[model samples]
Target: MSRRLRLLFTALALAALLWLLFAAAERALALAQRFLALPEWLQWTLGSVLLVFAAAGLSVLWWLLRPRRRRRPLPVPDRSSLEQRIGQLRERGADTGALAAELGELDRRRVSARVYVALFGEISTGKSSLIRALAPHAQVASDARGGTTREVGHYDGAFPDGRTLVLADVPGSREAGGEAHETLACEEALRAHAVIYLCAGDLNRSQADELRWLADFGKPLLLVLNKADQWTAVERDKLLARLTQQSRGIASAVLAISAGGSERYQRQLADGSTESVERQRKPAIEPLLQALDRLTAPGAEGLENRRENAVLAGLHQRTGTLEARTRAEEAERIVRKYARRAIVGALAAVAPGSDLVIQGVLATGLTRALAELYGVKVSDVQIEDFVQQAKLTLRTGSSIVLAVAGNALKAFPGLGTLGGGVLHAFAYALIFDSMGRALAASLAERQSLDQDDASARLKELLADAGGTRLRQLAALTIDAVRDRVD
Candidate 1:
């Protein structure tokens, strides 16, 4: 050890020894005086009893006062796996492209410097005042005007224990839409280690949508209802309840505070010099700061997990919406094309087996196309294998049962394979439609498939399209095929 560190340790050791001796001396002297006040023999007996009691008391005290073990944080998903998933998404032009990029950038920044926590909300929501109180050195205009700040402002602040952070106040949402600053707010949010979203009044539908966008970013967040100083207690509770209801599934740390009304603050004088003055300052700044400290503290599990989970959630939500639209627009076209191929294959066949050939060709082609849409690069063999799996599922499951029962040809045994073309064609369309829907859902959810589960999944896909929905989809697909035939 270095000389200074050695000497410091030595001094602490000596001080601790002396302090312990002093405490022992004080306790012993008091015991001695009380014991001495008794009869000589009684004094000795009582002294022994007192010593035992003291020892037991000390043991119990130690047990009660010892530091508790903290609960372990929930395990974070593998970052490499997450990154690879996101990379595939980027390749497919998923809706979460920007968030994936931002998270990538955030990981880089975490190793580069101090945490950057930003305050953002719509205008007149006390973002500026909060900044001024938290970082006196930072010059933020806090005259309580709507949309006063026109750009991002930076400030510096330190935790009580000396860790430092960059406090940022972004231009409120009022300026967020203008051509010049369209990306400014988002850029700031993307760079932040955590965000404090300030708001006032009841959140309209649009504002709630904006809140989802913020939540979707997956950063550590605090949603603050600013201007609490101006509100009555009842009014405040009502607003909180309303906002809490509206902001469901977003950040749950919603709070109310008045940064300007409850505290003293700094103001720029006429000549440009800043003056310190105290105001109502009731913005609950301390609670917010405490929350921020916990959130930005180094190696915090909740903070890290929340950030990553938020990104994953946004990824899931966006992918579902995009894949739904994409499938609706394109799956129909693919199905139509494959339906035509199935009809031709069946038309060229001999009786009693022509329908089986049509189903095999249709299932194979649709499987290949759907896999390709989901970013799976499959060869001819793989497509054929998947179709066989589906056929195995078809043979064992309810589809054949439904097919035979619903087939009017069963009543005309002599014409078993001669006159049921429409029913057969509609059944083919229904099977393709169900499989395509299941494949799209699986892809959107990023489910990793194993060949072991293929049979079960195929069965599920086939069985999920119960009678009514099947009939509906089958009717539409049949009409489209008939149009092509005509």
Candidate 2:
């Protein structure tokens, strides 16, 4: 199109918009004039109705856009109950020393009456530098290498207000092959009165997850962005805005500062020979200082309950893990014993059989023993039902079991000389091992005897023809046959 035509179209559009505005204004004025001409009482009634409608609309808008309050974290178990659980775990032969030590440390901190603040974040985020900045007099090692601080170190420091504080410098998390150090850092975070989570920039998925986990513990937390000197003012503002949105309910406050880690530079001597010189960078952490001051205003005594709760919650999780592991080991031992007994029973049977028969009494005994170990109460009827389900599964997979047993016999030639009973013995071993493992796994996961899940697992285990399992079963059958002949 020509320039002239384009200009004409734009002018016409503007003119149309102006005409519409003028007509609307004229109509509103006419309505207002007629209303003012009415009786005073009628005019007042109309105005009141308009005001009520406007107020209602405004209230609805506010309700739709309101910010939600943070939800409360789950309550941790009390100290006495936690101690009792630790004692129970110890009685069960689990190594509960670490859990007991955590409780002891909790008591010691309560008596010390010092506010503890832990510095926690990923590697190379300047956690060590921040510690040095916060406690100037204390000697802290700040290296350029990632994961340089490998343990938890406590330094005595004081706030500007003269309140004593103990700052813990913990190992940075997310280092390659640093899982043990990461666990150390997390445990120390739970022990402190508050935590300072440092980052050099916006958080990734892992950092956000770590932040939320700490927040769920109900700790007074501050998300600090270190190495702020790298970004421009506008960039810093935008980064802080994004960090704030990412950590809305999780962190109590988010701020940025330069921890002022040391810097090295080449200097010229009098003879023009260049030499490397290192010096400590000046720290700018006033905002961090102010936030800590407001956050820790309630001294160690005032915040003792929250600190104690966090510690106990951590111990509860660790103890539960140890309990599960111990139970699994014991369950395996029971499974082996039952499998061996099944092998002997199969060999002792006078009648030769092609199909698998689950010895009813022995099956029930194995199920009950595993149930008792896992603390699952099962009735006699339930045990019978579970055994029946297993029989049906075995009927379908028995051919597969016998085929695996035949292969085992061929693999170990010496078993063939034992007799025709050797194949049946190995088949019984496979069947009982599969049944016990499936039942144990289902009980451990569901904490109950789930017939359907256990049955499905049993079918899979029967069909599995892995080499290592076959070898182990071959060895077990050999030992059983040799003992029977002797």
Name the top lDDT candidate: 2
Which regions in candidate 1 have their CA more than 4 angstroms from the true location? Answer: 1-75, 89-100, 120-124, 128-164, 168-191, 197-225, 232-256, 260-337, 346-353, 364-431, 438-486
Listed in order, each prediction's TM-score against the native is 0.43, 0.83
Question: What lDDT tens digits, residue by residue, belong to model 1 across residues 1-486?
Answer: 899999999999999999999999999999878877889999888779989999999999999877544222233455566567656655655565665666766566556566778787777677777887777777665434453677777788777778887887877675535534435665776567788888878886656766767765656677778778679999999998887666655654677776764445799999999998875654467767777777787643335545545445444554456556665556656765675565455444567776787788677767777667666666788767767777766677655635632553344344344445545555555566555556545554554333335555556756563556554555564455556569
User: Model 1 misses residue 304 by how many Å?
Assistant: 6.9
lDDT of 1: 0.65
318-374: candidate 2 lDDT, tens digit per residue: 878998899898998898888888889988877645233437767899999999999
Error of 2 at 296 (Å): 0.9
Error of 1 at 283 (Å): 8.5
Full-model lDDT for every candidate: 0.65, 0.89
Superposed model 2: Cα runs more than 4 Å off: 1-68, 142-144, 264-279, 351-358
Score residue 444 of candidate 2 by CA lDDT: 94
